[model samples]
Target: MSLPTSTASPTPTRSTPRPATPSHRSGYRTGLRWLLQTHGFMFLWALGMLVVLVAAATIIVSNVTTPAGSIVQHARQGLTWFPFSIAIVGITTYTNIHIGAGLTRRSLGWAALTAAVVMAVAYAALFTLALQLERAVYGWTGWAHGVDGAGGLFTSSGQVGLVVLDVGLLFLAGQLSGVLVGIVYYRAGGWWGTLALPLTAGPILLATPALSTAALGDLGLAPRVVLVLLVLGAMSLAAHRLILGVQVRKLAT
Candidate 1:
């Protein structure tokens, strides 16, 4: 019995390996989903509703006062500020959480870029549609929808293509500028961030329809498009670089 026990051996147990970290591609997908789900969709719905409310109010005001200009046009400032603020939050707030969730900085950068593009297109389309609706309402009410110098990109709201192009560029610039601002603030502190406004927030100002019309209108659409693309490209590159080396700070409660 002792000899037989000595010949026997216990079976070895196998240890389970820990799961690998998510890939950058997967991280990008996750980041994009988080951005859209947390901010983009809600903002789009709110913006759409706001546009409708503004259009209705404008109609009422036009009918009562016989106003000469488009009230909806003034909503452009809100549209620009909304995306810009959200983009700043996306960089400052979400970046820490994103990295903590095991996502790569490169993924977050791409996600922000893609989200900006999507939001820009969506805002442009909604603004264009609002203009068309306002135009129809004005026609029905016999109100003169005059174009002011601020809306110099188009002679009339009937210019749907130009409206979309101008709005899209403006929104994209705002978003990119916001990212730049957020990164500067996060990396360089409040003072540097405020000081960097001319560099960080200047792109949106430059991309405004009125400014574009005044400065580059004579250069035609092609040159304006190239200029915008160049600005966007540079902003994107700067943001990407900043994100890559950004140190995640502990968020205050």
Candidate 2:
């Protein structure tokens, strides 16, 4: 009969699966890489400039009078503000770009925190080294190499560990505070951010061994350290919460 009309149904074709989105771990790694790549060179340039300025200041001060106190410490404020400003940009500009790249806010927050730690350690090490170098130079020139400020953790630059600890905590606080200020502004606008500055920026003040000691009158190293850690922890938690709930907005052309 009509060659037995085919009754078999046609086979269904399989659809290709879409590629998987990046994992949180991958996003964190990518975000960290992006932050360092974008900011590392500028940081180096700033460091180099600071070194030159410090050298010139040292020479001038030595010629005028016996160089007393850490010249590098006097310049420490610049170091603090530089990274603070960078961390602010990391939140305000990089956050949106990071999300647009298909990364999660959690990854960006972790990356930013990691970057701040990395930078703080670097600053502390470099600053400590600078102090040691200045001490050596002062020794050669028969000048005093005392650190400025009373009731501070370290009186001598020879106390390498304490110097590093002090500087590291201070820089870390400054960077974290910058992140807090940036996010507050991003979330709550200018007026609130400005008003919140005393609270948002308070960590840096508390972390400063000189300032904190001055205000609290030598609460002892352990107590000072504990206070700093508590402040840092609170700032980090607040920033983390803000970052998680932040809305990604379109950029203007």
Give each model a TM-score: 0.83, 0.86
Residue pair clashes in candidate 1: none
Question: How does candidate 1 score on lDDT?
Answer: 0.74
Q: Judged by TM-score, which candidate is best?
A: 2
Query: What digit string (tens of lDDT, one per residue) describes model 1 on residues 1-253?
Result: 0212311331121232333665665666677777766566657665777777786888688568877877777767778888788888878878888899988887777777777777778777777777788778778888887666545466677777778877888888888888899988998889999999999998777766433566654767777777787888888788778887888886678
Give the local distance difference test score of model 2: 0.75
* Local accuracy by lDDT, each model: 0.74, 0.75
lDDT tens readout by residue for model 2, 159-246? 8888888888888888899889988888777899899988888778767754345657747778878888888888888887888788
Off by over 4 Å in 1: 1-21, 41-45, 52-56, 209-211, 251-253
Count of steric clashes across candidates, in order: 0, 0
